[model samples]
Target: MTPRRRRMVLVALIVLGVGSAAAFALTAFQDNLLYFYSPSDVTAGKAPTDRVFRVGGMVPEGSFSRASGSLEAHFILTDYAHEVKVSYTGVLPDLFREGQGVIARGRMGADGVFVAEEVLAKHDENYMPPEVAKTLKKQHEKPTNSGPLPTT
Candidate 1:
């Protein structure tokens, strides 16, 4: 092949390779990225239904109703403006209970309930996970059914 023709082919191949790399990166993220939005954000129309995402909020007091020997339980996750009902049918975390901060990883069901595949509760008093502490502080600033949070 002529020198000029060979160089032109090499340049074209490099460009194609770069473009393919970028496209693959984007496609991988689109397929695997899992967003976690807060309950306030979800109520404010920030959560998308098409993709699986998470919702974090405070579990309202008296909102938890557990079935005997069954994992199915009903609860409410709320922000100040609105509340979302959740129905989870799995083992909850040890700290999971009423009047505590929780982050549920799942999608909103067609029936308007947040179907949680995983439920995370607030950690202990002094040794809370950084993420949970930050979220709890944000939720405590607002008032809803979950009232009178413990003071540090």
Candidate 2:
């Protein structure tokens, strides 16, 4: 082949290689991406069923329970408007407790439960994960009273 033709073919091959690599990297990134959702979002069917994602909310009082002889625990996560049941079969974080903000990472199970691979709790009494705080804020901002305010 002529030198010019050989050079053109090489350039085309290099471009193809780079394009293929980019596409592969993008696919990997997308597959590994984890999204955050509130319990309300999960209850509304907005969470992905086939991919790992995060659910954050308050663990309601009396909603947490541990198995008799196992590390497995079940709890309900709620954003005041909705709730999602979560199951985690491992030691929970030191700060994990009912009536506190928590976030769990996992995928939804066949039984509509969140099978958590990792569970995180708030760092302190005054601290809450940003996602959880945002969800709670949205929940509390909804007007509960439709009637106009009355003055004394």
Best by lDDT: 2
lDDT for model 2: 0.96
Q: Provide backbone clash counts, one per model.
A: 0, 0
Clashing pairs in 1: none
The estimated TM-scores of all candidates read 0.79, 0.92
**Model 2 residue 121 CA deviation in Å:** 0.6
Task: Point out where model 2 deviates above 4 Å.
Answer: 149-152
lDDT per residue as tens, model 2, 1-152: 99999999999999999999999999999988999999999999999999899999999999999969899999999999999999999999998989999999999999999999999998977999999999999999998867988889
Put down candidate 1 lDDT per residue, 40-135, tens digits, no spaces: 677777888776787777677888998789989889887544688888998889988777778788888888788888888877755544554566
Estimate candidate 1's alpha-carbon lDDT, on a 0 to 1 scale: 0.79
Candidate 1 positional error at 68, Å: 1.3
TM-score of 1: 0.79
The TM-score obtained by model 2 is 0.92
Q: Top TM-score: which candidate number? A: 2
Span of 10 residues, lowest total lDDT, candidate 1? 125-134
